[model samples]
Every structure is written in structure tokens, then in C-alpha cells.
Target chain A: MKSPFIAVSKSEFILYLREPSAFFFTLVFPLLMMLLFASMWGNDPFPGEEYGYVDFSVPAFMGLVMATSFIMSLTTSMAAYREKGVLKRFRAAPATPSSILIGQLSAVFAITVAGVILLLIAGIVFYDLRFLGNFFEFVFAFLLSAGSIAALGFIPASLAPTARSGVVIANIMYFPMLFLSGAALPWFMLPDLMKKISLVFPLTHAIKLMQGVWLGGHFWDYPVHLAVLTGFVFAGLFVSVRYFRWE
Target chain B: MTDNVVTVRNLVKHYKDVKAVDGISFSVKRGEIFGIVGPNGAGKTTTIDCIAGMHRAYSGSIDVLGLDPVSDSIALKRRIGLQQQESEIPDRLRLREAMELFSSFYKKALDWKMLLEQLNLWEKKDSFYSALSGGQKKRLFVAMALIGDPEIVFLDEFTSGLDPQARISIWKLVGNLRDQGRTVVLSTHYMDEAERLCDRVAIVDHGKLAALDSPSDLIAAHGGHTRVYFDASEGFDGKSLSLLEGVESFVNRGDACTLEVNARSAIVEIVKTLDVMGQGLDSFRIEAPTLEDVFLNITGRQVRD
Candidate 1:
């Protein structure tokens, strides 16, 4: 049997595709960061390695893109829709709230997938980056990371009273996650206490998992990172479902 | 088929310290345009919200088409269409896309092409929601509600922002819905709209059911007197006018004289009294009993805002 929620998902996807701001922030901005950083510090390598900042910055930039697209964009848009009575309008019909949430999450997931693919292509062509890990393991980690971040985004979306407040709440969590989770700055550079605090954020674990898979670390080596990201997916889903509001 | 499409008994709702709906009871028959009319804080919208299953945790029973609106919401939703007081589609969603997507939620939906044509929205099918005018957005909402071809339709503040022409067009469409055997439940504070369009009206005030009847019936029952007012002139006597058989009161405001008469047609009696007294009025007009007057008589206050 065909699930009716799929129709809503398709419609949401089309609407997202038509939004120019979404395209710029999700797809274009990440590649631009990679290019700009490569120009600034591409030649400087670590003490014993030939690879420069571009090699490390490219993967961190992927985490940044996921954080922006999945966490920031999804939370802001959903909360805005709720604030504008779009969710109430849907509730007036026969559509269920869970279906609407799934529809929105699927659209965000699809956009993240497309954005990551494009980023990977640019990484390989422009910076001569390669996937040292097994292709299937990288695929699994990438999808799990996106799912975790996307789910975590709904927490702020559900709690916010209005769209503007939703953006503010998301940014409150977003900037800290970006800087501390090795997206804007590497984890090794952070002080010991900051590193401990960063571990509490899902993005920190997500970036660790992504970097592990991208740089050939075996799946068995990062059990804690995998568990933490999976925990975010579960926790986010629980809170979002419990406090979901149609209006 | 049952005659009553909606039945609300002792319905009560509260918002923190405010009692928004206080034990209002009413029933709406199938194929009738039943109106819930009241002032801004009068709970008309709250009643509709309770009936539509948009509101929950109320104290009483609300049955719509033999289904409990809150518990059987999924089944109830498919059978009823709701045009909420404040609802908007996504800003970038085009008209046709919205219609198509909403129609998919129902088992029986009207043809989008025919619905668009009927609402005069065909020409603007490709327009984004943000680009449409206010009236057009309202029409689109109406179309989305009707697309389900549901047995009952609830429209809250349906014509609040519409121009006169658009309002009339919508009235015609509502009449068409009744002709097609669909029950309509409308909430509005407009007395003229209630008087003109409702088969029966429930006048709500201060979170209670003040009165419920046909517009004319309510007017005839509680609407006290027809007031005749004219400029206070030299020949008019307030004392004599107050002594007339059906005259309730005669107030002389220096600039104007208002004679409140019990009879519906007060002009003939007023002219007769004037002739007998050898008096003439300048610029006289009779104010007949309206739904507003009925509300005023029952609540002892004007419905403001």
C-alpha cells in the first residue's frame, strides 16, 4: 500500500527546491567555504604530513554544511511554518501530524544527501581529496550523521513559540555546536574542558564519525561516536513527538 | 440521514484565567447555514473550534455526524472541511500545487479544475501564495476546504476581510453548498451577514449562549421596539409623544427627538399622532429591529469589536 505521507514529502521537496535561500545556504555555501579556505591555507601541512589544511578543512566543512542545512535550516523553516499556521492548516485536513513531520524530515534528509554529494565531488576535483575508508561504511556514517542532525533540529522547532524565536533558539545551540564540534575549529586545538563539553553536543560525535569514515578509520574503532549520534536521533525524536504542536 | 449534523451539549472551554466558552449548547441541522454570531470575546470561534476538533479538553459532549470530534478526529476530519480563522499555506507554494496536495488527503475530493473555476481562481493557478491578494487567499482557503467534498464545512470568520462583491459571491457559493446537501457552520460577528445568510443563528455573549433561533425569530422575540428619530423641531412635543399607546419612551436630545414605539410599523402611528397634534418632523427615519438589536436586547450591551 502507498503511504499518503509520501505525497506530502514530495510536495515539500519541490517547495524546498524552489526556495533560492535554501539552495544557497545548503549547497553553495559549503563549497564556497571549501574553496575559500583552500586558497587561504591550502599549502600549510602538519609537522610530519604532506597534506595541508584543505585535506582537514574539507571534512570539517562537510560537518558545517550538515549543521547548517539539517539543524539551522530545518528548525527555522518548520517553526516558521508552525508560527504562520501552516501546520494548523494541514491539521485541518485528514493528514496526521506525524505524517507532516516525516514529510518535512524526508525533504531535509534528501537535501543533505544532495549537498554532501556535491561537496564530495568538489573536494575530489579541486583539492585532490580521497575516501580512505570503505565506501559502504562511509555511506552508512554519512546517512546516520544527517539523520541524527535532522532529528536534533526538531527539538528546537517543537519548543519554539514562533518562527523568529525558533531561529534564535536554533542559533543559540548552532554556533556552539559549530565552533566546539570541530566544524569551525579542530577538536585537538580545544582545551580539555572545552573538549569534554563539546562531547555533550551531537554534532561533535557526528563530525568525529564523519572524519573517521572519510579518513579510513575502521567502524569498530568509534563505538562511542556511533552510540552518541544514535542517541541524539532517539532523544530528538522522543522530545519532538512528545511536544509537537500543530498550531 | 440524520437531521442534525452537529450537536454540542454543555460545552465548556477555558484559557488559563479566561473562560472562553462557558457551557454553550446548540445543534446544527444538515443542509442549513447555521451561524454562530457574537462579539470579539463572545466564544463563537471557541464553539466552532470545539466542534471542529481543533480544540480539546472541553467539559461537555460534541458530536459531529455521529462521531466524537476529539477521539474520532481522523474519521471526523475526512468527513468535515474546516476553513480556520487564521491559516496560511507555505509562502512559496503555488495555487495549483496547494490544491493538488490538499486534495490528496481526502477520499472524495472535488475536481481541482472545477473548484478553481468556481472560486474564480483559475487565472491565478500558478501564482505563489504570497503574491495573491487577501481576498484571493481567502478564496483559496475556501476552495481548499471544499475540495474534500465533505458532509460538513466549518468557516470561522469566513468573510471578515472580503469586499462586498466577494462576500456576495461567497454567499452564492454557500447557497450552492446547501443546495447540494452539505451542512455549513459559520462563525461571524457581522449582524448583516447573520441576518442575510443564516438559516438559524446562535448569538453568543461572554462565553455563554445568549440566544439561538432564525434571524427573524430572534428579532421578533427579543428585539424590543422600532425607534423613530427626527431633528427636534418647534412643533414636536416630547410629552405628548411619550403618552401615545405603544410609545415606550420619547427622548428629546435638543438636536433630535427619538420615539421608541412597540409596533414594527411606527411611521403610520407617528404620522397620525403628529396630524392630531398639528406637528411635523424634519428628516425622520425608522430603525427596525435587526439581529444586532436582538443581541443588544438579550445582552443589554452592544457587540463591539
Candidate 2:
């Protein structure tokens, strides 16, 4: 009768540390891509220095890292465990239900923090951006953005019957959110249709909120992003918990 | 009621159209190695789960150590030790850490190091669960179930699919448990395991109780008669031995004769009568009944069916 939360935490950390490939995918890989994109897009081509291309894309790219670390990672891991009968064993263990989930959340969230730090460091050194907002807003933005996408994650987590299915469903969101949210492609340069399409995805609001906090903009708009993201976490938690099958 | 460590009254469990427990009832005495024998889906695992407070029965009452398993699970769980069907430990956790984590749950615990050594898994202490072989995993599970030094131990399919050597090792370990004064309740399909280990056994099928008694007693009660076979001399006629005392029927084929003997000392008398008839045999053998025969007689189906 051990606490499942502790089991999950210990297990996740052991898995993360034991596999070098996971480190790259979860930490080094995402950060490397963020750097690669920023390097390719940093200097605006053939123009008077309007909004810096690097400056604009940096925030969006950082948003993608958060989405991948918490949202994509959780959905994939949780779904695989469910399909493999790992979750069912958790239910019968000495650990309570709450601890199991909290353990998973903590592991994913810890990775999210590492990704966020890498993004911030790259943004400052490469883009020459100021820390316009206090530490509080930065923390809030990270939590809020993670909350929204992680909520959306449960959608795939519940539906996927196998690990492959989980990965496929996660990609369906990964491409749309990263590209349309102006994380990779500039939202301003995209066609009017693309702008409208971006509005449909929560990542757009997420990146926008991050931008607002980055620029130290109006607080009223910030709460909208936070609220929407919070709502997503709650909705996802309800669905995944109900439909999740352990083998 | 007296000296009963585990009791069930009219237990019923069903899933859609199939009844898993079938309103069965039986009890296990304190400090005894009780066994349940049946094929898969005979409600063995389901019954143990209900008794362990993991699954709620559709109806009927189950009391383990005089406490309701379903209603008072927390208190019961702390006292009881369990080895759940299939593997319950996660693949990622290491064996050394697993013992420590499980041991933390109880106020008093057996020495994890000693138990690991006893299970021959001391070297595997640092090995993660996913990497262990099936037998290693089974031993680890058995070790964990004894961590709390529980008064009543529940083991489902305790020894199945194991080599004869491994099975014997586990059987010896189980015997040691009884020597230490802990009650063990297990379900197995292997008749040899039941006959050699259990103090009492309950036979179940299609979610219904078929028979319950000590292995020898059940065999004696249901076993029809002792069968003796031998090679007869030339010109042997079964008709002449038909009138022999306690001989139900006599059959012969060329140089072989088979006598179906009845009552106490039937085999001894049959041999003596055959000797008097000058029926010198190439080989003579007594075919006594085993638990398997009794199971077949009670259920009209094989043990694994």
C-alpha cells in the first residue's frame, strides 16, 4: 500500500534519466529546435527594422516547447500506461487515486519548467529582448500555457488505444498549434484564412498571452488566456479520468 | 463460525449474462493452507478479489478475519497480505526500492533483506521489474506479499506454468509459511500442487462450488473403487473370478486381467484370491484415485475446462 503519487514520481524520474533518447526528446530536442528556428529567422530580410522577426518568433517558439513538454508528453505517457495495464495496477496499489495523477503531473510539469528556462535564455541572448515583466507574470504564463495544452492533451490521452495512436493524435495538435499560433511561421504574414484558423486553436491565445506578459502589456487581456487555459485543464481531467481504460 | 478465518455466504457475481461466483459459499479455518481449484473464469480470481476488498460482489457477504472485506477495506488491507493476479508492480520500479516502498505502509514489517534472500532474489535487488523474467517476477511478488507479515496471505495462481523444480521450491517456501503460523489461501489448477500443499480444498466451476474437503477425504468419498490390473496366465476366464468377494466385475483380454475391487482391503484380497487361482502375473499394479479423478466426477468436466 504505497502512495501511487510517489510510485509515479519515482518511476517517471527513473525512466527519464535512464533513457538518453528521452532526454533529447523531452529537453534537449525541443530546446535544440527552438534554437534552430530562432537562428534561421532572427534577422528580418531586406527591410527597415520593424518588429524583429526573431523577437516575434521567439515567444511563439517558446510556447511550442511548453505545449510539447507537458501536453504532448503527458498524453503519450498516460495513454501508453493505460493500454499496457500499468494504470490498472496503480488503481489496486496502496496509493490513492489522487497521488497517481499528481505524480504524473509533477514529472511533466518539471520538464515544462526546464523547457521554459531554455526558451527564456535563448530569447534574451539571441533576440536582445528585455525582461519587461516581473517574475510573477512569467511564472503565471508558463503555468497557464501548460494548463491549456495539457487539458487538450487529455482528448488524445482518452481516445488512443495504443502508444502509436497516442503519438498520431498528439501530432494532429502539434502541427496546427505550432504553425498556426505563429510559433514557427509568422502569423502576420500568413493569409487571412490562416489568421482566422489560428483563432480556433488555444495555442494562439496562449502565445498571445505570453507576448502580452513579455511586453508588459494590459493585464485585462492576460486573464482571458489564463481563464481559457484553466478551463481546458478541468475539462480534460474530467474526460480522461472517466474514459481511461487500463488494458 | 468458530475458528473460521475467512467466510462467505451465498456469494454471487455476474457480468452481463455470465455468472462468475454463482452464489457459492465456503470458509477457511485459521492457520490452515486452504486451496481453490478450477479452470480460468471459474471465479477463483474474482472470489479472491472480493475477499481482499478489491472488487465488490453483486450480492452476499464475505468476512476475512471477522471483518467485512467490502465495508471495512482500509483496516483489513493494512492487516492482510496480497499477491494479486498478473503482475501488480509497475515495470519501471526496481525490486530493492519496491520492497522499501511497500514496507513503509505498515507499522511492523518483516525484514525485506531476509525475504529477498529467501526468495533467491538478493542479486536482483537493483533490477527493474520490466527486465525480470516471469519466474523472477513471481518470486518478487511473493516476497512483497509477505512484507507486512500478514496473518492471512492471499495468493492467486501461486504456481502455474513453472518448471517442476521451481514449483517444488515455491511449494517448500509455502510450507515454511504454514510452519511460521500464517494462513494461506490460494487457487491453483495443478492437482499435484493442491494435493501436496492444501489442508483443505474447495472445487468450483462455472461460478459454483462443486466440492470442499481435505484432498484425501474428497477422493475417498467420491472415488468409486480401487482398480487392480495384471497379466493373467493362459486360458484365463473372468467368469470364474466374478463371484470373488468385493469384486464388482472382472475383465480379461488374452494374457491380461483387470478386477474392479470394492470395500476396505479390496486390493489385498484381490491379490490373494488371484494367487490362489494360480494367476501368476508379469506385473501387477493398484490404480488408486487422485484429486483429479474426484474433480472429474464432481464437475463432469476437466479441471482446466
Candidate 3:
């Protein structure tokens, strides 16, 4: 027989695909944002930068994909499952709680990776995007950024008691992070106070690390961002495991 | 060696201010269909939850297959199957997928394809869970519970929402489980289900076990009296039935007469009495005491919420 982890992960991945809203937010929405932003700001090079606007925007959009896949999609699904008693049913089986958690995480991570690949494809096809960074460094930074956000998602997933409240909690955190973190808007365009506030959000650091690494910089270049994101990953995991309710 | 597969001692559970299961005790023998029957909020489900290790009791001890349910929960889960009262699968999940996913959770699993077919879900294997009817969904959960090929199965309100035909089929399926030497513990509010399916029935009321015995024993002890009704003849004296042997009480409603008899043999005396009275015994019917009467006798006839 197949392992519980594989069985659960496969079912969750299939369920994610069948969910129209999750598919829209994770894949379609990101590509649409890329098209809209690229058209508005034209792909011309920034004042002092060699790369065009689309080049930097593509990497930053990867942060948006992580946020949506983890915060909005993953959190809501987990809470909904709890509300419907699916989690309680799973608990009655022989599978451990860790198996369910890791299985769900793997599925959401796969979706986030797919979303990132789609953005990359769109950038290359539509705007002739450039990449001067080391492929290994970019991949490493991408994984860290996505993993941190995915881990943080469990906080809201464990706290929300119902699916509707899960959406409310996710949206409460999602919109502000989207605008301030340079995911839906550029960081340089933000006012000084807003920029200061944006630094408090994990997505801001994610965008910084992803943009830096994608533009020929090593991950070690952003020590503060790396430390902040790593802290969030551990804290999120701790809280979720501590407070998670099966029913 | 004892054949008892489950034993509960002074089991007590409370939800904040509400007492869900209060000092309930019982034992389930192996290869028998044991039932916990009660009205809504009677703690039937709560007791099952405690024994199944789904809920930790506020106080008390539970041993299933000689393992403590609270401490040996994981090990107990491996050998027991549970179909919860208010649990559901993801709406988008297909029937086949749900089966396979649950089947993989056990060390040894029955063939999911055969289970699905036996449950009449093979044709709808690809149907989304939300698309199935309520009865089908119940059957699907039952199938998932059995896919692990567990030694013991706990079904809470297993056939509550099922139609008559569906309920009968599921009852037969449960009977087969016991015949195959698996201990089956089910909770239900349907008195007929308990009387027909269970080898022994536990009557619960207000979070306490009111009575526990076989269906026949319970019926004989507390099922009240058998009622015999017959159409009344014009100018017939109703006072005559009160004098008949074994007739505990008699009521006349002008058009009909009803006699509460203490024994089944009273029916023969009733017929002879009516014949002697020249009523000709027309429109005669006998209502035997059932488990429902047993419940009403022990728990009172007041409607429960």
C-alpha cells in the first residue's frame, strides 16, 4: 500500500485543481497581474538599473504567488476542512497529524511552484525578460521565500474556526501585504511611512530577497530579510502545532 | 478467556456546563452487534466517541480490546473503524479517491473496489461527493470505515438520514460484519433498528444508562403491556372487558374498544370474551409491545430535545 503522506498529498493536489477560486488566485490572477503591470509600466529599464521593469516585476510577482497560495488558498481550505469535520474524520484513522499537515503543505507548495513557473513563462514570452542571476541561487531563494510564507499560513489555518472566518482573516492580512510589500505595487513608489510599515510584513522581505537574488545577487546579500523570514517559518510552525484543533 | 472486546467503567464526560455522558458503564462482547439507543442529547453519541477514542472523557476508564482508549489511542485506531455522526469528505473529492485515501491509512486494507461495489457505489465511483444523495453519502462513509478491514467498527447515527430501503440494506451490511466475527457497536435513535439489529441494546436517557439487556429481555421487563383493539358493537357493555383475565385496563371510545393485556395469551381470552359478549370480534387487531415502548417506559413519554 502507498504511504499515508503520498495518498493525502495526491488527494489534496487533486482537490486544489478542482477548486476554481484556488486555481484563479494561485495561477490565473498572477499572470493577469503581470500582463496589467507590464502594459502600464512598459518594460523599459529603470533610471539606474540595467534590467527592465518587467524583469524585476516578474520575481516580485513570485512573492504574490506564495502569499496567495499559502495565506488565502491554503489557510481557507484547512479551516474549511475543519469546519466540515473532515479533519476530525482523518484523526479517527491511523494516520498521524503530521502526515496530514505535511501532505497539505506539499500540495500547496507544488501549486505555488507551478504559479511561479507560469509567471516566468509569461515574462519570457511576452516581454523578453532577462536573467543575470545564478540559477542555483535563484532557486534557493525562491524555495526559502515560499517555504516561509507557507509555514506562516498554518497560523491562520489553525486559528480560524470556520471557512467564512478563514476568508476574513486571510483577506485582512492579504490586501495590506499585497500593496505595501511591492507585490501589487512597486516599493520605490511608496511614501516613506508606508515603506516603513511594509517592512513589518514577511512578503516585503520575500520580495526583496527574490528580487535581489534574481538580479545577480547572492542570498547572503540580504541577511536581515533572510533572518526575518526564517524566524516567521519557525514561529508559524510552532503556533500551528500548538493550537491546531482537529474538530 | 473472556470474549468481551470493549468495557467501560464509570465513564463521565461533560461539555463545559452540559453533561454529555454521565457515569455510563457497559461491555460489548466480540462478534455481536451492540447498540446504544436513545433520543437526541441522550449521550449515545458521546459514549461512542469516548470508547472510539475520538473524545477524551472528563473522568472514567475505557478499555477496548484490552487497550486503554486514551493512552493507547494510536494503537487502538489501527484496529478500529469509525463512521462519525457529523463528519464529511471534501465536496470535490470523488468517491473512488476518498476510498483509496482512507484505505492507505491502515496497515492492512480490504480491496476498495470490492468495498465500493458491495456498497452500491461502483457506478458512482467517479461522482463528486457533493453530487451524491444523502443516503449515498452515508453508505460511502460506511464503506470508507470498512476499507481498513478493522477488527471493531463504531458507527454513530449510522442510518439516521437514510430512507427505509437504504436503512434496511445498511442494516443487512452491519449484520454481515458480525457474522464475519467483527464486533460492531452502533448508536441510533431508531428503536426498530435497535430491536432488529442489535444482539443487546443499551437504553440511554439524560446522559445515563437507563437499562441494558437483550431486545426480548428489555421488551419483557419494561416494554409495558400489549394492546388489543376491536370495533365496538352497538349497545355493547364496555365494563365487560375489565372482568376478563390478564386484562390490566380497558378503554372504550364509542366506536372502538382497547384492552391493555399483561400477556400474549390474553389475546385468546380477549377473542373468547368478545364472542361471548356477542360483539363478534369484528375489526380486531393486536399491537405487541416493542422497543419503543421499552424506551418510553424507562425514559418517560416526555419529548426530548
Candidate 4:
């Protein structure tokens, strides 16, 4: 007999594949953005910079991918399940609340990894993207960044009363984060006022940590970014477990 | 040991200012199909929700299979199954996959493939949920509920939106569950369903249980009079027919006569008298008292939403 976690995760993974909007955003949308930016900015490295435009943007785009997959996709799916009474059915069964949460997180993380891998391949093949960072450090930074954002997803997932409202809340947060977090536009291009405000967004810290590690810098070199992301991880999970509703 | 599998004492639940369930009490015996029947918003679903532990009552005590529904919810959930009134599966989920997924959520489970076959859904195992018709979707939920081999099953508004043919098919599936010695608690607004399928019926109105008893007993006590109508011949005396035993009253309207009787034997006596009168009866029909009549009698004739 399969464990409930495994069963639920496998079911959720299949459901993720079946949702067209989630598939397009997580896997297809990021690559399209990468191509558009690489073509527009020309892959040549900037003055005194070791990497080209695509190389710098690839890690930042990964942050955007995490936001879409976790903040948008995961929240909407969980809210829709609650609205449809699917969660109620699961609760009536032997499946625990932890099992459902872990299953959803696992599925969203798997899709985020797939999206990131696709973006990386596009950059390395078409734009000659550089990878100067240590592989293990980069992996650690990626996991921490993605895990924190995915945990943060549960806040909207728990608070949204319906799937339609979940989409509204996600978009309200997503569009602002995309423009302010340096995930779409580079950090240096922003004015000092915008940069100061961007520090308040969790996605900003995620991109800072990811970009730092991808550019051959140690993760511990950015203590504040590390702490902020770690704090979000704990706070998000705490709020979700404390208040998540099954129906 | 007591045969009662479920017992509720003064179950009261409130939704803010409105009382959803007001001091309702009932016990369900083992291996019987018990029904909670009422109009829309009469708190039938709310009562089931309380017993299933889906919602906590404002003030009440409930015991299901020797466990409190609130404190021992997880254990009670494992021993019982629920089919909610408005729950749905993902449209993209295949029938076979859904059965398999739900099957893993229990310690002991029936063969899901066999359950599908029993529910007449084996041929559509690979079909997505969106592809099934309304009746088929209802049957699939029942199959999912039974996959865990629960000792008790709660089905809320089991056939609320089904066509007549579909309703009958679902009724047979429910009968099979009762035959397996599993206690079945169901709620429906269709009185005929309660009259035919339920061993005992609890009629609820305005969040209160108006009456609870076997269908026949309720019909006998509060179902009012059974009317026998026939086209009366010219020169027939309605007063003579009214004097017959068990006939409570006689009324003549246009060319027809109606005999209100308190017992089934009164119909035979009236028939014999009509034959002896040589009135040559034509076009006769009987309106027997049913659960609907009992409901109207107890709950008043006001229409409910």
C-alpha cells in the first residue's frame, strides 16, 4: 500500500501537468522572458562585467519562476480545492493536514525545478551563459530561495476564500513584485528610491541571494538577505499551519 | 451490547444569529437505512455535518460507534465515510486514478477496481470526471465513499439533482450498502425516497425535528386521511356511504364523490357498499397517505425555499 503523502503528491503532480495556465507560466513563460531580454539587450557582457546579460538575468528569472509556481499556481490550486470541497473529502479520509501540505509543496517545487532547468538550458545553449559559482553552494541558495517562497505561498492559499479571489490576490502581489524585485529589471537600473522600497519584498531577497551565489559569491557573504529569506520560511509555514482551512 | 451505532443528545448548532439545528435528538441503529428528510434549509445537511464532525455544534453531544465526534474525530473518520452534498473531484482526474488515490487513504480498503465494476463505472475507468454524466458522477461519489469499507456511511442529499431514472439507480446502490450490514445515514427532500428507501424517517422543519418514526407509523399518526374518489352515479346517497365503518367523511363535488377513510379496510367496505347500491362506479382512484402528507400535516402548508 502506498503512503498517503506519496499518493497525494503523485495526484497533485499529475494535476499540475493538466492545468494549462500553470504549465504555461511555470515552464513556458520564463523561457519566453529570457529570450526576449537576451535578444533585446544582446548577450555581450557589460563594461567591466565578467558575464553577459543572459547570465545575470538567468538566476533572477529563476526567482520569477519561483514566484509564479508557488505564489500564483500553488495558492490558486489549494484555494480551488477548498472551494470545491476536495480538501474536505481528503480530511474525511485518513490523510492528515501535514500530508496534504507536504504533497502540494513537493509538487510545486518539482515544477519550479523543471522551469528553472529549462531557463538554464536556454541560456547556456543560445546565449553562452556563464556559471562561475560552486555547484553545491548554488544548489543550497536555490533550495533556500525556492523553499522560502513556496512556504510564503500558504499565506494567500489559506486566506483566500475562493479560487477566483485567490487569483485576484496573487496578481495583486505578483505584478508589483515582478517590477520592484529586480526579477524583471536589473537592480542597478532602478533609482535609489525604488531600490530602497524593493528591500521590503521577499522576492527581492530571493533574487539577491540567488544572484549572489550564481556570480561566485558565498551565500554567507549576504547575511541580511539570508536572514530575511529564512524568516519568511518560518513565518509563512507558521501562519499556514495555524490557520489553514480544509473547506 | 446496544445495537445503536450512532446517538445524538440535544444537538444544537447555530450559524451566528440563525439556529441551524435546534435541540434535535435521534439514534441510528446498526444495519438500517435511516433518513433525515426535510425541505431546503431545514438543517438536514447541518445535522449531518455535525454528526460527521465536519462542523462543531454550538451545544450538543454526539457519539458515533462509541467515539465522540469532536474529540475522537480522526478515529471516527477512519471508521466512517462521508459523501458531501456539494463536493467535487478535479475535472481532469481519471476515474480509475481517483479510486486508486482514495483507496490509499485508508488502513483497510476494498478493491477499487471491483468497486468501480460494482458501481457500473468499470467501462469508464479511464474517463475524466468531466466526461461523466450527472448520475454517473453521483454513483462515482458513492463508490469512493464505500472504497474504505466503512462501518457507517453518511450520504447528504444523495439524489437531489438527479432525473427520475438516475434517482432509482442510485437508490439501488444505497440498498446494496445496507445489505452489507453497514449503517447508512442519508438526507433527502424527496418524501417518496424516504417512504420507499428508509427504515425510519426523521422529518425536520425550521431547524427542528417535527417528527421521527418509521414511515408507516408517521403516516398513520400524522399523515391525515386517505381519500378514495369515484365518479358518482345519479341518485346515489353520499350520506349512506359516510355511515360506513372507518369512513371519516364524505363529500360530493360535481359528478364525483370522495370518501375519506382512516383505515385501508374502509376502502373495501365502501367498495362493497357501492357494489350493492348498483351505482355502477367508473373511474376510481385512491390517494393514500404518505410521508409528504405527514410533513404537510406537521409542518403546515406554507411553501419553503
List each candidate's DockQ score.
0.50, 0.27, 0.75, 0.68
Per-residue alpha-carbon lDDT of candidate 1 for residues A80-151, written as tens digits (9 for 90 to 100): 988999988998888876788788878877787787778778877776775567888877887788778877
The TM-score obtained by model 4 is 0.95
Worst 10 residues of 2 chain B by lDDT: B84-93
lDDT of 3 at B110: 94
> Where's the lowest-lDDT run of ten residues in candidate 2 chain A?
A89-98
- Which residue runs of candidate 3 sit more than 4 Å off their true CA positions? B238-241, B276-279, B302-305
The per-residue C-alpha lDDT of model 3 at residue A190 equals 98
- What lDDT would candidate 4 get against the real structure? 0.88
Off by over 4 Å in 2: A1-4, A43-59, A121-129, A151-165, A182-202, A218-221, A239-247, B1-5, B65-76, B88-93, B100-110, B233-242, B254-256, B275-282
Model 1 Cα lDDT, one tens digit per residue, B87-194: 899998999989888988887788988999999999999999999998899889999989889899998989998999999999898889889999999988899898
**Model 3 chain B: lowest-lDDT 10 consecutive positions:** B296-305
Highest lDDT against the true fold, candidate: 3
* CAPRI rating of model 2: acceptable
Worst 10 residues of 4 chain A by lDDT: A89-98
Which 10-residue span in candidate 4 chain B carries the lowest summed lDDT? B296-305
State the iRMSD of every prediction, in order shown: 2.1, 3.7, 0.8, 1.2
What lDDT tens digits, residue by residue, belong to model 2 across residues B1-305? 39998999999988777888999999989899999998888999888888887764469989898788867775776677878667456577788877876675566778999999999999999998889877888888888888888888888897876777778889999999999999999999888789889999998888999999999999899866777889877777767567777888888877777778776576677777778888775588888778888888888877876
TM-score of chain B of each: 0.91, 0.92, 0.96, 0.95
State every prediction's TM-score relative to the real structure. 0.89, 0.86, 0.95, 0.95
